[model samples]
Target chain A: MKQWFLGIGLITVFFSQTVQAEIVFVTLEKDNALAIVDPIAGKLLKTIDIGQRPRGIILSPDYKYLYIATSDDDTVKIFDAETFVEVGQLPSGEDPETFALNPKGDRLYISNEDDNLVTVIDIPNKTEIAQIKVGVEPEGIAVSTDNKWVISASETTNMIHWIDVATNKIVDNTLVDPRPRAANFTADNEQLWVTSEIAGTLMILDVKTRQITKKIRLDIPGVSADKIQPVGVVIDKQRRWGYVAIGPANRVAVINAQTLELEKFLLVGQRVWNLAFSADQKRLYTTNGRSNDISIIDLENHKVTKSIGVGRFPWGIVSKP
Target chain B: MISRFFMNRFLLKIILVLLLGHTALTYAESIQVIKIAYITQEKKIPAALSNLDAFVQQKGLIGAEIAIVDNNTTGQFTQQSYELKKIIVPVSADVVEIFKQQVGEDISLIVSNLPRTQLMSLVNLDLAKEMLFFDATTTDDELRNKQCQDNILHMLPSRAMRADALAQYMMKKSWNKWFLVMGMMPADQAYAKAIKRAAKRFGIKIVAEKQWTHTYDARRTAQSDVPVFTQGVDYDVLVVADEQGLFGEYFEYRSWIPRPVVGTQGLVPTSWHRTHEQWGAVQIQNRFKAKVGRWMGEQDYGAYLAVRAIGEAAVRTKSRQMKMIKDYLLGSDFALQGYKGNPLSFRAWNGQLRQPVLLAAARSLVAVAPVEGFLHPKTELDTLGFDQSESACNNLNKETLPVKPLLKGTYDSENANSYQQIIQQIINKIKQNF
Candidate 1:
């Protein structure tokens, strides 16, 4: 009777896992469009005209609205998550490339790359509340889950700035490797993962003290060291794996989160830029900017199951349940 | 007793506010001032084949100015400030007095827009011992090699780096046969020598080599004359060494075999160009255009890097001393963002800034080198210029104590025209002897 029960449970879990994710949205930089795909069915549902140079994409906490950073337009466009219709706009300062939305979904911090300022916006009011001055060429930005500190990683300055959420001022700074491309905070808010594109290394900083806990040198056999540029970084909430998209190397480094070590390299599309995880975290989606597609990684088996062609130069991705 | 105690408390509060205000004022005044000197000789730029190309009278100085603005912006946050002192002299002027003048004023950092001869003169000046000089203009390889000084750091890529960059792109395309065309200018001859060196290093064959002897303006006549000039060689590409904008532009679409041209013209290899828009370069390019009403050229970009490097080193080390700044810059920890897809650092063997050279056409960037498959154990950038083993310059990492004490001096900018007469006589005598 127990064997029979286990067999039935296996079938149920398989089907449930198949339907874990509903849809995935990818922003195309060159084509200026958003590709909607059904990850379970592995189908490109449709594509809609997005905006000029759509790069950074995020969803509201409730998943009712979609926020896209149209970099060339110098504004972040808001859309109805279900209808895929433009709803509003946020006043992102000049040349917004990447941004972070607070866990509360009330405040949004935009990285004004050229201006070297993090412009904060009240999402509901669609108004600029504060613009915190940071380092030069600030790109990577992340707000802690508790919404206490917002971290801005400056590319040229090689420094990470800690912005207090309550005050919207830079409270502290930590020096990192050259050309830090992205930053990701763990769900528990204990660790922060930063990627250095030029150094080809991933730095894990202790969030409490802002001290770099570990530095993982990203490398792949047969791939030139210069091509192992670490860009987008994401960590599993289960603390199993931390995946970093190695740009131009065309591989996602699957790091062992528990051991805090590099485990394996999962081959992906060309110029793999950003990554997004499904709501249930069953699958991972990576936008390959050069290949113009998204590589879907089945997290359970640590395999790239499929590569779905998107629009031209897919730069950003976000998956929905 | 209560009234007296309240009066004393009010007085104390007033005094406390005044003390706090005084400290703030003093802090503002005490911000570290990093003074820099920009020296450029006003040399005559060769007239372009057409009016399409721009010629800036103030080439590297504008870039330094823009960088000063950039430095001051970062300074506001770092609690530091920057000052630029420019000294523009005529092409024939002796720079010794100005060099002494700059060093006397405690300007330990200097940006040089001078050519090799003028730059070497400054490098040899007795007062230049304790100062750091950034060569922003010249691409002379000799400065990074045989003539290298411990204090001189080059912002411009050597001619060898540019040639190697172009050669790499050509190698990638399988265009191995290069036809070499030489010009008479000393700069052009130096460029050709570097090209020959690159061809040998990369194992590419030079199908034929010819010197550009046509002296007349080829603007209108290039249509008929270029085909004849380029007729014989069945080469994959024409590599011209016209640094003075001579006949290099005429080879485009005018080649006998319809081959493409590369080198100083056509698809040129450069440190920075107006058309380069990758690796977050567009941000700086846009900012430059907004500040100065023209596209930033190679020397301008070089000058910009020089000032920014000083600013960066100052912020990193938090020191105003020249020796400390120089040590930090040459150390392993110094990495600068040059918007070239790599973190630039100076080579300890040669004071040259190791960078990726851009192969660009008129409209867009073709590719960046050291291209794929070119490997170096230390860094791929070492593939471009003189490697540590190949370079003769070794004083970069060693301590260079001040050779002579600086003396205060006042300057006369004029009366240096006779200096050229002496060099002219020497050249004439050498020509007669040869």
Candidate 2:
């Protein structure tokens, strides 16, 4: 009996460690700092500042480094995830707003807003591999799970350019709502969701068919009109729930992922920009620019659990493990 | 213990089956029906209804239903057909308050084809909270200017936009000195005032001003006419503003004027004309004549476009919800398959629908205005109304608004550039130009 109880205790310890793994790095918007946050306690442990206006952050699948698109300085800053220190910086196209890293971490797709071009960066050597011309004012970018296609939203054209990842050429361009600011693929990889800020609506396009399947209108009064802009969007792995950040309203709209029904507004700080979830999926964090704080929401209750002090003008958020 | 576990599993299976069945039943609920209230004159009801009916049928939208309310007849169109609910109250009556009282939660949208004063009454009610109002008539600039409302979607072009188009064309010809001749009527005076405002903006100097009055007396034509006085002024253009058709046609080839005449007569600016053949106008004109069984007029096109805008919004959003449709219409890249060049979109600053103004000579389309160089901060198309930086509305956030610096140069110089070069230069020059 003693031996059996000891074995059970060992298993419990292993399970808890796996569930509560520490966050390896946290990317900052202002100083381009990658702070090593103590994930278990949710505290900022250390900070390493890099390039200018660092945004659109993501971690390599291998958990080696974090890549951030520094828009103002026109470079992509790479930092070692373990040490939270700047490893290298890659030159990107002009006014790089958002980017996507290839599944193998071999190539980076960056959307250049001012230049109307998508720059492909080769990862190992930190060099630009190719530059493909796209429509006017390309802002948001998302890569396919299979690494076959990279889609970027062109704001002025009101369309999404689907580029062939291998050839670095535009394969297809599909019309979407006006001023499509952000885009993300569903977990099942069947549908692409785009948010049009001026249109004040969310457009869902079928990935395989390349056709708009549905356009869901947000009902929040002040948030659905002139300046009521809808910006960031994220879908859960199970495709059960989706969340979108309403820029002017300063709140995140919780939506039923399957039905596309707007559930309710989860109030955050001023000028809510982008959102990301913790690895355990228990907490959701949003970068509120005006408040200069990160709003932490308890996902289960759909309420603001805490507002953590972060860098000035926090614009983008990404979780690292 | 094994049997108990199996029983629990069986119970869970039963509950899951029942839940799925209930969900399917809920999904089978009927689609929401959209109710539209259409208010117009008795004479115009039959034509409007038939056109709308045919359009709805062609579009395959089976859910929308319209209720016509005619104000001219004693009994409304509502009484004649079961689908209609009520008639629009008479103009002399308290129609504004009546509409407010009668507009229930069931009404999704209101289509009004009424006079200017009547339309203004409806606009004053602020019915945007309950229903969306589509104004098919009323060319009053105030409706689109100081009296502009969030809920009101204008179908007709304002007087200022039309006058500005003509003024722009005149400016292109370097016709700076204008002989302004206006009638005694209120609309004529207002139109003349609008013309003078445009002349000032486009650098056209009003060299002389004259007024004509309609009279029943024998010596009226000789006495009321300003031809003798106008001939003495040194002017490059003659502008006549006559609403009652009093002195409009007489000003065309009068002995006094050696230059081109514009405004209400010789070269007038309008929304649509029969001879407009460029940029897919021929197709629209042909289709409209075929559908309506008559030559297309400005009012007819305006009415048709209002409905078409709604249809386009519905098709794009894939829903009939008023709020969604409204947002979609106001969004950038909203192209209307009509007379306007490229696609028509709402100006983000003033909420005015940006469109190419048509200048008509007699019954033929002559030119499109803003005549090139009359530039706004953001777009050349924005030169029609108030610029964003100059707008007096305090509700908007000035920080996010684009500050377009005024483009300088005479209209003649602007008309020199090729179309492609202008488009290319516009795209390149703008900081965020699309």
- Give the best candidate by lDDT: 1
> Which is the leading candidate under TM-score?
1
DockQ of each: 0.38, 0.01
Task: Assess each prediction's global lDDT (C-alpha) against the native.
Answer: 0.85, 0.66
Winning candidate number (DockQ): 1
Model 1 misplaced regions, further than 4 Å: A1-21, B1-30, B90-94, B398-434
Question: Residue A28 CA error for candidate 2 (Å)?
Answer: 4.3
lDDT minimum window of 10 residues, candidate 1 chain B: B406-415
Candidate 2 CA-lDDT value: 0.66
Lowest summed lDDT window (length 10), candidate 2 chain B: B69-78
Docking class of 2: incorrect
Against the true structure, candidate 1 reaches a TM-score of 0.87
